[model samples]
Target chain A: MAMVDVVVLVAGDGVNRAIPAMLLLLVVLLAGLLGGRLVALGVALVAAIGFAVLLPPIGSPRVEPAEDVAALVLFVAVAAIAGVLLSTIVLSDRRRLSAEQGTVEALLRVDHDRAALLRSVSHDLRTPLATIRAAATDLQGFDHDPAARTHLLDLVIDESERLDRIVGNLLSLSRIEAGALLPERQPVDLAELVAACAARLERATSKLTVEVRAAEGLPLVKVDYSQIDQVVANLLENAARHAPPGSVVVVDVERVGESVRLRVTDQGPGFDPSVRGRLFEPFASATGSGSSGIGLAICKAVVDAHGGTIAADDAPDGGARITVEVPIDG
Target chain B: MAEADVVLIDDDASLASVLAVGFESRGYDLRIAATGGEGLREIERREPDVVILDLGLPDIDGIDVCRHLRQRTTSPIIVLSADGAEDRKVRALDEGADDYLTKPFSMPELLARVRVAVRHRRALAAVAHDEVLSVGDLAVDTAAHEVALAGRPVELTPKEYALLMLLVRNVGKVLTHRAILDQVWGPDQPLDTLRTHVSHLRRKLGGGAGAPQLVTAPGVGYRLLAPGDVVS
Candidate 1:
């Protein structure tokens, strides 16, 4: 009676253990289809170990060790295949996403260029046409007035020069974009550069009081002199154009350790919140309609070429500030 | 100062012809060239005090043209480029251009540049002969490496001295940021350092705190004010 009771208890325990082991095998098989190779391999390993531990001693009467090894090899193969498939899908999706992003950026640039071309063309063509128009208008009244004729000729000359400038800017933009533009880097004194830029700004606008600060014993920096001049000039010009009249345009330059920063701060309404992300993008002007927007974009590209970083932010004085930072060699 | 003769080169015939009349009215002797080769040939013939060379040309690369012209004459060459590439301007200057005007520049601005170029060229020639610079109360003796104000020696640092020499050398003429950088700092120093140094020099030169003798030209470089030029 005692032997029969012990046998019944062992049987009940074995049945209970087999059900869970079998359920675990089912979970592993299903997981192998969707999981990556590593995950599938982990599940398979756990299931195999669990089954071995749970199997009754009666199972020792059945399969050979070589057959068991073959079954383990087959499970590993399936897990590896699942992992490879998952990796391939993930990689391809990433590639597609980047390519799409590249296409959109290119499209945006193209649109910007087209708009710039049109704006410049219209403005340039207008000047020459205005000149010719005035000339013809004067010629029609030539017999009656010499002063009118002289004035008309002057107008023609002025307008023609304006057209020339427009054409020049268009060509310049192309060269810069094509990487054909090269800067003659040299040691430049910031104090003089700022002072010069400030003087010009002072003369150009009554709307802003321009101030320049250059500390004593500042070190000279390597740069393309004319190019930097253009950068500073464009910034000041942009500030003068955009900042409200009677506001201040502060052009400041300072040395940080291992770097130098030049900042052009303006007292006017700051950047439009909508286009902040795209501010450095070509033609992404904060001023809604009138600004070329290419000015800041070109500035950013030029600074980048010099291995410098440019950023725009609201000024402490409550306007816009454009800061350019370039690394100095140790 | 009397008006100076200038040689203007561009392929645009109508525009050139109109500009000729305009320059004439402004008391300038103007010569026009339609091509790079012709402009070069013209430069050899007259050696005009100033040459306004357009970058877009039929025969030669504008940079090459600038190089060739530089080899032939010391006359100030002001490049007129349609491209705003800082690199292009730097290259032009490297190739011997003294300055540049981007496309769509204001006529008044262009004329002002021309005037400065002519004045600068004459100034350079004068320095080659006289070797001294006198502006307002400041006198720079280039040969002696000396600066004096009202007959008193003004002490300056090595960098300040170099900066002063550069400014005095090109007095009344705008030196671009790159040009000044190249002249004062060795070419290896970065631009931010250049700005920092310029700031330091300004403070040292008494261009501090509202009173400034040095002037900044927007999108360009620096210029030391000429005599009688008041700063408010």
Candidate 2:
């Protein structure tokens, strides 16, 4: 309406006002295109009144009143039609722009995840492989020295085991990422499972002692045996890796109504408070131990698949504690 | 007596060769077969005292090979596989493999398992012996379901007793944590639970002053050492 008034005032008395009135109609239509139906209707009404009152005095041949009225009606109809057409185009274009932006953002996020995964894999894999190669070479060079030979062999064995673990974690993570994990659920004895995982860790890391405590007569939890085993094993491994040597890694299990809770607490340094939120995120290693950094993430995935929750926190006793709670029902 | 004959069937040539060197150093007759068919043929040619079969064989399924071997021979079969899945281990055991070892296993651990498997097989074939196994002051009556330390009967929970019994039966032999869990607490018991029970059993039996000791092999399993038996 303001633009229409400006055009009408500028085309006063010196010239025929028909061209300026047409320009005023164009301005109203543009306002409607950008501002939707309400603004377009408001502008159309204002433009019609302004042209009715101002056009005749500025006409070249002193036009009659009837001609002026017909001209005013024609200008209003044309403005309304242009407003509807342009408004539909504008609205559809806005929707399309937002949809395109969403796709681009998703693609960029996927690309970022891929790059992080590759960087983690390359770095983690190279470390143990390098250790193994170096140890193997040392073994050959130190063959005559029995004690040195034994030490080198031990290094080789340890490095190979580490490599095995990293590879296994990568495989499990990929499976989880790809939505390929289909857990075979059954009645699982949580105490027994915890003990088994601890025992395995105990065998692998002699310096670390794993202690298990479970509530008396804890009910059986329904979960996939192997996947759950991996979850517990991964958690125990993470605790062992971070905990001080010879310190006890305690595993506690209890029944909480319909859910069973499994908590693993270590005696090592607790996680950094700032990184606690990202503790379960893949490739978010606090220790920078060249680990694949997917252990806790895998635990999270497996627990989620079983309708469970997992969390990382500082233990009351000054170490990292990871808690996993899974429902007993299907 | 002649050394026990052993056969290892695996598709991993590097691992197989390294294991061959390890076994040869230990004074056992080691034979290698790269495929399941070759493994079966080798087994048919000579009945080995123990057979080590890798589940991920090149020619045939390791479980099928284990099944076939079990059908033909009574020899103990140890299944080696890279898969750590519980079901795979259970299935391999169900197919008559006496023991299952996941890959990346240390040579000492593998050798210990072989010894246990061989000892177990020999014991099964021997004539019936006295039901009581006495190691120093610690005595276990297999027939009576009793355990005694220093002339006094020691009380034990059912799980504890079961665990103690397994160790007493396999005295001086390293029992892998998995084996202990499977035999004592059924196939699905937790590993840490086994440790807890072992701790309890140790406390009850008493570990000093001439009593038999349950020595842990650290990352392996537990072994019951008689009073005079040195743990090396």
Candidate 3:
């Protein structure tokens, strides 16, 4: 302001002082940048009054009406253009800041999950291996005790199965990601598949009751039999782990339009509604239960291969309901 | 069954050693061959009671080996396949391999599959065409076309009768869905039809104290388990 004032005062001829026009022009741009046309007009009147009082001898600059009006119009046009550009930059800066914030949040979440996954994978793998090691070592120490031998052997077998499940799921995820798991579609009886998975898991632990219900003549879905079997088995594992001991984990299958929906309902404390979206995320179940939290993620991948959809929700009667729907024809 | 001979054709020495120990404990003789050529030679030297073939060999295509082995020997071949290689397993079955088990399979599961293959081979050789084929209390008297469970007459359709006869012939062996569909209903039958028929067979021949079990191997096929068969 002082530099422009010095230049304007040195150049002004008092009567036809046109240098104040430049100062008025700067004020007009700031007015447009700050407020709408009404406010711009108000600021212009104040600036003109200030110029008249503050400069004194140069009462008004460029008193010729035609040239003065033309200068004011030119100043308003320049002010509006500068205002639009400046506002655009400011708005864009705000948007960029928010986008960066979102990226930081997502990265933090991924980092946390990666650490959680590492912790979970280590626990899942080591717990079983440690149990098997202990049981096998103990069997060597116990001399000719049949009961102890049988118990230790069972521990070895059961723990080995647990380890196998974890390793299998992890390997499957990599294979699936590599596009190595192509679906070999075939007609399958979902009930039979569930029963087999349930039977296999039941043998490993007789803790939960599995009741698989598929209508006698339910429509057979065309899916990759092996992959779909794996998907259902993952769901069953999740349900079985969550369901209380001696409670029934209900697995039922039905056809809805072109899709066959399979649901797993557990009697244990179900998931919170807010966790519905993240249920299929890897390591979402990393609660230190020695389960491969990657099961649900693998299930999602397999189901996706069949052009299917899988979701998690709170069951009506209080428990988690994990539903998988695969098209009848893939 | 006097200790049936088991041949394992796999390069993995760890599996061979473990299975050898298991077979030894069970009084079965296990002959390990590390490649396809050696496996074929072993089979030709003296056709083993059961051939446990690995579908991944260093020398030849495992499926081709399965085909050649099928051509040379009538002994049961149980193909050992990798976990995700369902296509290879099915192809081996189509190439006349008797049964298959995925790798990383449970020791007990592998043993049971091997036992089934051995029992089926021995049982088939001992009695090729019997008038009355019975497993547990369930009998299919092909002579009179009579089906009876524990002395009670259980009537079945001709298709069911034929299916039961086929399963009876290969007692403990797991017949693939393709193999069963091809042999039973000719070809080009929907697998759903086969699954429906099998489920019906299971429902009628229900489980109890002393009844035969029609077990489904999920994505694979069905096997009829009698009391003394496949008990490893």
TM-score for chain A in each prediction: 0.54, 0.73, 0.64
All candidates: DockQ: 0.01, 0.01, 0.01
Candidate lDDT (C-alpha), each: 0.66, 0.73, 0.72
Model 2: number of backbone collisions: 10
lDDT of 1 by residue, B90-113 (tens): 677667787677654545556667
Give the interface RMSD values of the models in order. Answer: 10.1, 10.5, 11.6
> For model 2, how does the per-residue alpha-carbon lDDT over A143-167 read when each residue is reduced to its tens digit?
3356545655765676677677778
Error of 1 at A248 (Å): 58
Query: Candidate 2 local accuracy as lDDT?
Result: 0.73
Task: Rank candidates by TM-score, best first.
Answer: 1, 2, 3
Q: List, in order, the clash count of every candidate structure.
A: 50, 10, 0
A1-330 in candidate 3: lDDT tens per residue? 433443444343443444665666567557655664555666666665555445545554543555445444444444445545555665677789999999999999989967766656765675455455545544454352565557557767876886788888878878876888788988888778888888888855366778888866777888887788778778777776666668888898888888888999988788855556687887765541335478998998889888899888878998888889998877
Docking class of 3: incorrect
Error of 3 at A216 (Å): 79
Docking quality tier of candidate 1? incorrect
lDDT of 1 by residue, A214-292 (tens): 6677788877776677678678867866787688787778887767889988987887787788998756662212334
Q: Model 2, B31: alpha-carbon shift in Å?
A: 46
Q: What is the C-alpha lDDT profile of model 3 across B1-232, one tens digit per residue? A: 6488888887644356456655665678899987789999999999888899877665677788889998999988888764344667778877878777755555566667777777767667777778888788988888899988899988788888888888887777667888898889999998988888887887778776567877776677777778655443
Q: In model 3, which residue pairs have backbone atoms overlapping below 3 Å?
A: none
